[model samples]
Target chain A: MSERAQQLLEIADDELLLGWRNSEWTGIAPFLEEDVAFSSIAQNEIGHARALYELAGRDLGKTADELAFDRAPEEYRSAALVEPRFVPDWARTIARHYLYETADQIRIEALKASDDAEVAGLAAKIDREEVYHRMHAEMWLERLVGEPRVREALVELWPKALGVLGDDLRPLLRERLAALDLPEVEPVERGKHSGELAELWEKMTVVRRSVPGATW
Target chain B: MSAQEQAFLEYVQGGGQVETSDWMPAEYRARLIKFIEMHGNSELMGVLPEREWILRAPTLQRKLALTAKVQDEVGHAQLIYRVVEDLGKPRAACLQDLIDGKSKFHNVFHYPTKSWGDVGVIAWLVDAAAIISQKALLKCSYAPYARIMKKICWEESFHILHGRDVILTMMNGTDEQRTLVQEALDRWWGPLMQFHGNPIAQGDDPSFSWRIKSQSNDEARQQFLDGYVPQIWELGLTVPDPKLRKDEEADRWEYSEPDWAELKHVVTGNGPRTKGRLQLRRTSRAETDWVRRALLAEAA
Candidate 1:
């Protein structure tokens, strides 16, 4: 694969997996309105993933669905940060939401500066949607920042949050955290898979695998 | 009835609309709340079955569509509960009643969704059945509800399309896929028939007289059959009822009597999946209790 294609797959995989994790709260979110709002965000993440996969698929000669769902778990390039399941835990869910949006904003900003016009254009479009996502996450962050449980959850997930960013973007994330008076933690860098991704892949691909060579 | 309530009834019967702030009889208000609350509860509970498939959706497109569809249902629940809240009960209380089995939702929701095909059938047929009743609500005497029904019906149109697309794709695919759709249809046919409720004369039903429901139970059922049976038949799928057919000369459908006993049994919280689904609702509510408290505290 071309370097551009590989780069796109990494970002796309992160989104696909993160979207999958976020959707786990579809019906059972804390309240009705929030349930609807959060589900939209989940759909948005997957949508962003699909757009990215389509762009990447062009270079790899595959369809977006194939790129998104057909890859082996070992071939998945998602960050460990987006791999864990967080249903029924609003604290950690929000903690992850706030952190991932922060990290994704940084990454998208860099992609928006890419020399490839198509990549740059898609990045710009994704950044437009992420604006609301950021607002939502920041809104929750402001509300829960004063709570001890939220603070603990943020602290607990801080390392994983750092893993979502590359070394170049990690400094920017740290700067943002420092502005919010958040303490820095050791980074859990990307490039490794946990058992969590394998489990998610199992459920995600079960239906598609059941009837091989069938269109759904 | 009191002279005041008698006047209110006659006004509604004569096609008058009632606003939330308008004068209404005590019985009218109570009846409105109960009916609307159950509709809201059904929308909320309806999410559980489809949510499972959102994870297992075969393609990214299917996954996105299913997730958005589920999201729309939750949105519908929110809009519905707001109307109910205006009527008297709070949204939280409605939810509590739902999980406690003190209230009821639609019969179809209480059953299990066994496969990807069930998802398609539900979106196509179950939603088709629901849209029939909801369309009747467009002429409801309660102005607030009738207004919201317009938006709800508009969104339901897309769900039916999505469902038909899913089913059609499966039906056109491999033999295994076709079998999946057929089996799902077989399992769902009973609930779909019972969906509009037992056939009752419009004059005998209180909901119909109040103009809360402008159509009779059998009227809604006939509408559903007229609209969907051909769609089902054209796909080479059987209706699972040997007696089901259109009576052209009589201008009505002739079918075996729906199992009213089972409809009552399932909706009363004894269906195959009701206990497990409600238990999930109860547990999730308990787990999120602190989140609501903390968030509300901050807002206050």
Candidate 2:
């Protein structure tokens, strides 16, 4: 209901959806060590969502679970960028992963300075953990940079990656991308849901919706 | 078989620890891979039975814990496969062998999990059986596998605690919840009994001969009983075995014989849920194949 609550919800929704999408690779990632490391990142994303939901829930009169699983598909405030189930496609997954972490880093930096101290504090903590994600993503990005498939995938997904960061942060994101030697591309932008979100929401909410009144 | 191998064999028989680059006969290397590969397969296959539960977990805590648990299984698989890799087999080859069903995993993982109760019982009892063997592996001659076992055993300690907490909560809940736990135990009893494998003599088992398994099959089963049976009894849940008892003089557990033929059938990939579970793994891997090829240096 409050502006702060809405802001938290959108960010939380993005994280929850992205976390859900990323976890699809839990058992099937390319390598075992990376699989473990990546799964931890996915869990942490969901964790961030939960903590954000908890903060947002206090004002909305809802629990974190209610906020996470109780929402209808269209009611979700996640960006389209974080919604796809790109399980088996390492190229697209990494492109999206590299892009999202970049966008998230930019956004979290802004959140870290929010007027709500708790919001700012939590964002700061999350940003610290994202450092590893960035390292891991960048590691893959560097390795794949010389490869044609990864480069092509990056070019194709750049616009959507740009869309993840809001207009206010575009200049800074662009500046950062340039510093990293990445070429310019249009962003897919926030506020729109990708086709992937609907399917993800369906599976995610299925169990929680079943026997709704009973505690698991 | 040779005079040198005979001496090497006697050393392991006397509790000698063998490192990776240490002197070993060809037989020891083959036996090591067989035992450890099965373990790696067990961890990888183990993920399937519990993964669906992550989707169905009732609460955020439950979802997170279950997901982490399953994730840990994948991690364990990775860790295990690395050890196997060091033992002269490539990970890809090991995976190839696994999907082909040319190797075996533990029996408990082959059966279907019926309810949330099954999940708890598995995390509790199955992991308990595994930990008994794993703790023994902490002293294994294979340094790499044994080193990894320390981490595996430490992490498993948490899994068992989480499992015990889950079981206790269900048991202390409503009648329906209690029934869920009891029903799950009944269905799982046979598999749990067969978990440590048939009580083969340590001397006759090559795994034991190489000091790869410090405890005998029967010894591991008895330890599981000794550690967990009382805990089960205190919770007021029946183990479904009428002859289940501990002999004070022999210090051995006596229970009705587990269906060895059934254990053989299930582990060889013919349990009721084996094909379906393996099918899921096959499909998911196929679906995710591009990711590996795209990212892995060697695969690329």
Candidate 3:
């Protein structure tokens, strides 16, 4: 794959997987208002994924659906941080949400500077939508900061969170964590897939694969 | 009825709206709480059947659309439960009643969703049926609920369009895809027909007497049929009911009567999936109980 296409696939995969994970909380989020708010964040992530996939698809000569659903499990470029199942666990979910949004902002900001106009334009659009997501994540992070369980969840997921960004971007993530007074941890880099991704992929692709090439 | 109660009734029947602080007859207050609480419960429960599909949505666009649709339902529940709270029932109590099977939700939520077909059918037809009932509630005598219904109806417009888009896409695709829509329509038609509730004479229905619901149940059902049946037929799909058709002379759709007994059984918590769904709700609520407490503690 071209460098530009590979970059798009990596970010698109991360957003798609994270969005899928976040959407699991739709009906079962801790409270109704949060359920609605969090679901919008999930939808936004998926929307971001779709745009990114479309951009990549233009390069690969495939449709966004083909990119999103028809790929083999190993072919996906999503980070491990986004691949876990976190439903019914508000603490971890919010922790991941908070961390992911913070990291994603850095990535999106860089993408906005891309030499390719299409990538830069899409990043600008995504950044506009992501404003609310960052606010939502910050709100929850503030609310849950003092809770022991949430603090513990943040501790647990910190390394995975760092995996969402590349080595070049890792220092920025670390600096942001330092600003928040969160502890430094070794990064869980993204080359290897998490065990959860395969399971998630199985469910996510079931309907599409049930009738191959059929419109949903 | 006492003079004051009769006056309140006459006021509502004459199309007067009541605010949260207004003087209301005891029965009106109680009935309004019960009626509105059920609507809230139905919206919450309605999320369950469609949520599973959120994980399995075939395309990114469909996934996002379905998530937004379910999100809207949850948001509607919040709006409705807040209204119920103002009417003297706490949201917690309403949720407790729902979890304990001490309250009712609409029957459509009590059933199972078997496939992607079910997803499209629900968004297209179930939401269509719901929108009809909701449109009628625009003039609800309770100002708060009527106000929220306006937003609810506006949001629902996209759901029906999204649903129709899904169905139309499948219909225009392979035969198996089209079959999915037809099979789903077959499974869902009965619930759609029964969704508006068994017809009750406007004068005899307490909800109508209080102007809580402006239209009769049958009126809502007819509106759904008139608007959607042709859309279904044009797609070459069949509703499960063999006798279902519009009567030209009566200017009404005539059909084999929906099983009111089944409707009662389902709303009363005996449908195929009711027990499992309630259990899921009970368990998830317990799991997240601390999040609520944690937030409340922070607020305090």
Please report, in order, the local distance difference test score of every candidate based on alpha carbons.
0.92, 0.83, 0.91
Q: Number of clashes in every candidate structure? A: 0, 8, 0
Instruction: Compute DockQ for each candidate against the true complex.
Output: 0.90, 0.43, 0.86
Descending-TM-score candidate ranking: 1, 3, 2
**lDDT for each residue of candidate 1 in B216-289, tens digit (9 for 90 to 100):** 88989999999999999999898999999899999999999999999999999999999999999999999989
- On TM-score, the stronger of 1 and 2 is 1
Which model scores highest in TM-score?
1
lDDT of 2 by residue, B195-221 (tens): 888978777888887888788888888
In candidate 2, the residue pairs with backbone N, CA or C atoms under 3 Å apart (3 or more residues apart, or in different chains) clash, namely A88-B288, A90-B291, A159-A186, A159-A187, A159-A188, A163-A187, A163-A188, A163-A189
How many clashing pairs in candidate 1?
0
Q: Which candidate model has the greater DockQ, 2 or 3?
A: 3
Ranking by lDDT: 1, 3, 2
CA deviation > 4 Å runs, candidate 3: A179-185
**lDDT (tens digit, per residue) of candidate 2 on A90-181:** 77888888888988999999999888899999999899899999998998887666666677777777777777767898888777778456
- For each candidate, give its TM-score against the true structure: 0.98, 0.90, 0.97
Q: Rank the candidates by DockQ, best first.
A: 1, 3, 2
User: Where in model 1 is the C-alpha error above 4 Å?
Assistant: A180-184
Predicted structure 1: lDDT: 0.92
Evaluate chain B of model 3: give its TM-score: 0.98
* Model 2, C-alpha of B283: deviation from truth (Å): 4.3
